[model samples]
Target: MTVELMATAEHAPHREEFAALYAQVQQFYAQQMRILDADADGGEARWAATFTEDAVVELPLLPAPLRARAGLTHYARAAAERRRRAGSRLHHWVGMLDVRPRPDGTLHTRCSALAHATPPGATSKILYVCVMEDVLVRAHGTWRTAHRRITRDDLA
Candidate 1:
């Protein structure tokens, strides 16, 4: 079962309703980023669970789009290893979110995403600045990403 999101807060017919939905979406991103930043056992799986089973992830750095949870999990695991080898940890910070309710009941969202890498005995530095767009669907009482596209500033 999916809940249809209301319009954006600025022009919403019901301000309270939109505000609640906005808070839920914000919390979703917070939890998702927390899982992505963690380097504990089952962290990959936890991060993968933030997306839908058939989610698609597209990145300019990748040769091909990663399809489904399995592909996403593999990518997360590999990325974790690369971070480990570099002796750095990555933190994904997202802001300036613009979310609109789609006619088909999904939400179209875009945000500024910044990634910082912190190495042992070194201060964190910005590694990537990107624009992330997502097609979000509400299912099982929570929002899950159905599709994600990342456009890095350096690559753009």
Candidate 2:
């Protein structure tokens, strides 16, 4: 069974909630960069922690994990390769989000996403467009992603 240690936070109000939500979103992508960048100082773990005990992630360019362990393993391999190949840098940009509170107190948030990887000698950015759907839970007065899914709109 997956652990719910990361799903404990609360939303005070609209303003406060948005503030927290925005932070979470920003952190989420930052962690992704960490995985790409290989900064293990909690980024990857925190990223995985964002999900629920039995959360799910769907990536068009990747396979869905049967569980968190599998997910982490897949990510580990993907990261190993991505870290190589001399490139300027790869970044993920998150856009306007639509966040809704579920009946069970989990937040369902969706946003337009763009993943850009710039090569060392490339003049253009390779962009990946998708809608990122996330499920966030509030536990122990903290908000973390319980689950996330990236539905690629158009692979580039």
RMSD list, candidates in order: 4.5, 7.8
- lDDT per residue for candidate 1 within 84-135, as digits (tens), equals 8898989999988777877788888888999999999999999999999999
lDDT of each: 0.88, 0.61
Residue runs of model 2 more than 4 Å from their true location after superposition: 1-43, 86-88
71-115, model 2: which lDDT tens digit per residue? Answer: 755575566456454535666777666666677877777888787
Clashes of each: 0, 9
Model 1, global lDDT: 0.88
Q: Which parts of model 1 have CA positions greater than 4 angstroms off?
A: 1-7
Q: How much is 123 displaced in model 2, in angstroms?
A: 3.4
